[model samples]
Target: MRLSQFFLPTLKENPAEAQIASHRLMLRAGMIRQQSAGIYTWLPLGLRVLRKVEAIVREEQNRAGVVELLMPTIQSADLWRESGRYDDYGKEMLRITDRHERELLYGPTNEEMLTDIVRTFVKSYKQLPLNLYHIQWKFRDEVRPRFGVMRGREFLMKDAYSFDLDEASARVSYNKQFLAYLRTYARLGLKAIPMKADTGPIGGDLSHEFIILAETGESQVFCDKDWLDLDVLDKAPKSAEELQSFVDWATGFYAATEEKHDPNAVPIPADRLHSARGIEVGHIFYFGEKYSKPMNATITLADGSTTPMHMGSYGVGVSRLLGAIIEASHDEAGIIWPEAVAPYHVGIITMKAGDAASDAKAQEIYAALTAKGIDVLYDDRDERAGVKFADLDLIGLPWQIIIGPRGLEKGVVEVKNRRTGQRDELSVTDALARVGA
Candidate 1:
């Protein structure tokens, strides 16, 4: 993408309403624009990152044996009523009425709708361990939505519903999603610690919230320091016992959100206890028959007895992750995106846009990287060098290949690492190689 042709309306100054680093940076970088109090219109640059995050979530869910299927945003009020949560869900639920005067709602979550789907079609234990997921937009009308997408009223989410014949089977589904969440965050360059958390309106006996540590995080969290170095993804657990063992090893360390924290319950030494503010990126719940039984989502056992299928719901805040990632990764300059989730792998900045040498070198580097399947943002605009550099840093591509007349005269280009702020002068061949590295 060339800055000259791209529709990036980057701001020179931060938006006054943005209270957090992520929100401010996002606005300044022209990644998103607020449509309302809690609603946003993702611009071109922002949509690229959002799509990358959604893809990672989808890949991880599929890797965990979860099938993908999209459901509607608007749901029949009858489903929530059957689940006995229509009124209990409170004001956050955006209740609406259709032209026919039938009550409906923009689903805050999909437990009731998912249960309705399963109940209508699934009839036997043979489809027992089925897990289905979808990446879609969701709305929860926050009383005072703030902090950009972090606390947005409308956002994208990846919610997976698991159906099992019994409690033991349901746990396996939960463990699968638990590991998937860990892998998902790791791929996105985040170290998410699984913390015991209240199920809240989801209503379950067991729940875990995957949180990423950040100074600007919304809530306080406590966990073992060792969690920062754990490698559960090196080799995935395959059996039920292995999965359970993985869960045991992961949860053995003390970890809890503010609402569930208990200093006295922690067995770890004070030195090993790492307390920090964290942002919730994902959540999982094993609610047994919480939705299934109430909605009569039943399956017939081999013995011919009908029983409510045990169910669990897993959620990843797809759009919210942009804010979380920025919170966890940005510096004073701008967002330093992880390689996997960066809008572009390399940015080609021509210090002198019209200069023969600099423009030629920038085009050469950009073409080379582009042909190699690297996403390169070429700043071929007739802007001052400092303005170009500032915009490049603000957008925060993983690598920046700087071309200047002087550098081209020296037969070299400067390659800079956005995250480390390290710059190196290298030949065109070497700069391209370094970016691949």
Candidate 2:
């Protein structure tokens, strides 16, 4: 994409509303614009990153054997009533009334709706162990929505509902999601630790919150230092017993949110302990019959007896991750996007857009990169070299190719690594191979 043609309205100065690095960089980089308190319109650059994050979530969910389905953002208030939670959900639930005076709501979560759907169609044990997932927008009217998309009232989410005939079978499904989340975060260049968590308002005994440690995070968390090195994917479990073994190992360490933390109950030595502020990026829960039983989502057992299906809920903060990632990855310069989720793999900055030789060389490299299936954002606008460089750093593409009259005269271009801030001059072919590779 050419910058001249692209609608990136990057700001030279930080906006007053931005309180943190992610918020400020997002605004200055022209990735998003706030329309209201805690609400934003993702611009071209931001939307690309958002879609990439959603795609990774979808891929991991599918890899874990979860089927994908779309659910409406607006749900029936009567659906919540079925589970006796409509009024209990409090002011955060955006209640509404249609012209017919029927109660409806912009769903904060989808447990009630999903359970209702399962009860309507799934009838027997043979249909057990089904997992349905969707990537969609959600809203929760926060009383004090702040910190940009980090705590937005409206955002995108990836939610998956799992149904199984019994507690044992349900665990197998839960374990699949556990491992899936590990792979998902790792792919996005985050080390999200799974810590035992309470099922606030959701009502489940078994739950885990995936947290990424960041100085700007809202929640204070305590965990073992070993978690930084431990990869959950390395300990993937295939059966319920194996799953329990892995869970036992994870819980053996000291890790909990403030609500669940016990200062003196930590099992690890003082040296091996660690504490930090963390952002909650994902959560998994096994709420045996919590939604299903209340909603009468029953299935016939092998012996012909009827019982409520055991269920679990898995959620990834699709939109919040953008903020969380920026919080964890950015430097003083700007966002240092992970390679997997970068809007473009490479950015081509032409030092002199009007110079015939420099312009031709940049266009040639851009074409070659695009032809090689690489996404390149070419700054073909007639802007100062310093301005282009700053924008390139702010947007944080993994690699950048700098084309100038001097470099073109030498039969080469300058290649720079955004994260390392390293520059090397190489022939156009060598530069393309290095960045495109």
Best by TM-score: 1
Candidate 2: C-alpha RMSD after superposition? 1.6
Model 2 worst lDDT window (10 residues): 232-241
Top lDDT: which candidate number? 1
Clash pairs of candidate 1? none
| Residue ranges of candidate 2 with Cα displaced over 4 Å | 237-244, 258-260
RMSD after CA superposition, every candidate = 1.2, 1.6
Please give, for residues 1-437, the per-residue lDDT of candidate 2 as tens digits. 98889998988898898999999999999999999989999999999999999999999999888999999998998889889999899999999899999989999999999998889999999987899999999999999999999999999999999999888888878877888888999999999888888889888899998999999888788889998878766776766567767867766767888777888887778898788999999999999988888789999988989999999999998999999999998888889999999989999988875998888888888888888899999998888999999998998999999988888778889999999999999998789888865
Give a tens-digit lDDT track for model 1, residues 1-437. Answer: 78889999999897999999999999999999998899999999999999999999999999889999999999999999998999899999999999999999998899999898888899999977889999999999999999999999999999999999899989989998999999999999999898887899999899998989999898899889988877757756867679988887888878887777788877889899998999999999999988888889999988999999999999999999999999999988899999999999999888876899788777777788888899989988888999999998999999999988888889999999999999999998899899993
Tell me how candidate 1 scores on lDDT.
Answer: 0.91
TM-score of every candidate: 0.98, 0.96
